[model samples]
Every structure is written in C-alpha cells, then in structure tokens.
Target: MKSITLFLCLFTYFSASAQESCMTVENIKALDAQWEEKNLNPDPEFFKRVLADDFVWVHNHASMIDTKTSTVKRAEKQAANEGSDTRSRIQSEVKVAITGNTAIVTGFTIVDRGPTPTRYHFMRTYVEVNGTCFLTGNHTMAIPEGE
Candidate 1:
C-alpha cells in the first residue's frame, strides 16, 4: 500500500510538470504570434506590452536595438517603409524549459519570403519577468540558400 501511494504521488507530480511545460510552449507560441502581428501593424502600445522595458533586439546584420521603446519605433519605421504588405512569416520551433515562474525559450525564426522565398534562422532567447515573457537576446545564423 505504501509503495502504491508513493508511485501515485510521483506520477501526479510528473504529470503536472509535463502540463506546465506544455503551457510554457503554448505561451511562447502566442508570444511569437503577437510579435508577428505587432511587426505587421506597428502598434507601439502592443509592442510595449509584449516586450520588457529593457528588451533588446539583435538583428542578423549585427545591428542592435536596445530598449523596448527603440525596438518598437524601429519596427514601426520598417513597417512604414515596406508599406502594408510587410509580412514576416516566422517558422519557429519553440523549446521551453520552466523553473518556477521563469522559463527559457529557444527557437529559430525564419523571416521574409516572397515568391522565390528567402529565409533566415535566428536563435532567440526569452525570459519571463513578473509573469510576463520578453525576448531577452538573440543570435542569428544564415541557413544555406536551399534550406
């Protein structure tokens, strides 16, 4: 009876942990979608809410935008320059590991493709602050032309 009870408790704990991990993945996916929409529409308020105040965006070209305000402004400017058709379709595979209230998400983002299709792979890290998730940093690597 003692062994059975212990096994049940351990199973329950592991099940709950797995559920939490799944939730974290879902949250990351939602975050990615929100960012994509923000980039497309260029809403500073939405961008601000999604990203941490001290968020920093490191472009694949080595240009970096530090601060959420600057990042949003930059996104707005880029959207304006590209017109309404500005679409950044990201193929992100998120892996989230949670520790207490914080989770680390690592993923690749593939951006901007026309009829011919060109893509860039970026390794991004996200940190959760006060129950809100924000992109902390990133390092991008160019994939092969065919890939």
Candidate 2:
C-alpha cells in the first residue's frame, strides 16, 4: 500500500509539472513589443503584470540600472509628457530561445523616432510561472553612430 501511494504521488507531481507550458517565441516577441510600447501610453497595471517583481533594466547610453518601480515611474512620466510618439520598432537579427520555463532573446531594434532612426542591441530574459510569462531582465547597448 505504501509503495503504491508513493508511486501515485510522484506520477501526479510530474504530470502536473509537465502540463505547464511556456509561450512560443513569436508570442513572446509580440508580448515584449507590447510591453515596451506600453511605455508610450503607460499602463501601470499592465507593467505590473508583465514585469517580474525583481525586474531590472540596464539602460543603453546612460548605463543606468533601472528597477521595476523606477521603470514604471518613468513610463508614467512619459505618458504625462504626451508619450514618445514612436510606435514602430523594426527588429533585426532577432532570435529567441526557450529552455524549460525561461526564455532568452537577443535582437537589434531600429527606433524610428523621426527621420533619422537610431539602432540599439538588446538582450532580454523572461520566465514563465503558472503559464504566465514575465520580463525579468533587460540589457541594451546603443549601436555606435555609424554603419
């Protein structure tokens, strides 16, 4: 009786864990863009939902490390300033990999703020819990002003 119960418990645990699935690369990419664009309109609740509690972002030029709270505050402020007005981010060299419940993505973004576009290289990490994915870390570096 004890052996049968232990076997059943282990099977139940593994079955439950296996049932949990992560988001696809395409889905994750869309989600990333959505969260970033939210900065323009600044949805505090959405930000809270998309970002992990310990989220961290390393800025490009300023090299400032931003926590989740600070990033959300900046987004709110940006919305107060009438938003950035940049909606299109053309991504190049994009790649996304998933391992278990975590995903790592690397890409370059061409930000079209005006006639002259700026390029940035970025790597972002996400993790899924209970079928929901959240951004955990983001590191970006400005591509030098040249080809």
Q: Best TM-score goes to which candidate? A: 2
Cα lDDT tens digits for candidate 2, 1-147: 999999999999999987866578987888877765675467777887889999999988656999899988877777778776676677778789998889998988877777777798989999998889999999988787875
lDDT (Cα atoms) of all candidates against the true structure: 0.64, 0.83
Candidate 1 structure quality by residue, lDDT tens digits, 1-147: 999999999999988865553237678767766766676666766766777666666765766545677877776776667634555656666566667655565566655645544465655566765446777655556566866
lDDT of 2: 0.83
| Regions of model 1 farther than 4 Å from truth | 1-23, 78-85, 113-116
Backbone collision count in every prediction?
0, 0
TM-score of 1: 0.62
Candidate 2 residue runs with Cα over 4 Å from true position: 1-20, 85-88
The local lDDT score (0 to 100) that residue 122 gets in candidate 1 is: 54
Q: Which candidate wins on lDDT? A: 2
- Candidate 1: the clashing residue pairs are none
List the pairs of residues colliding in candidate 2: none
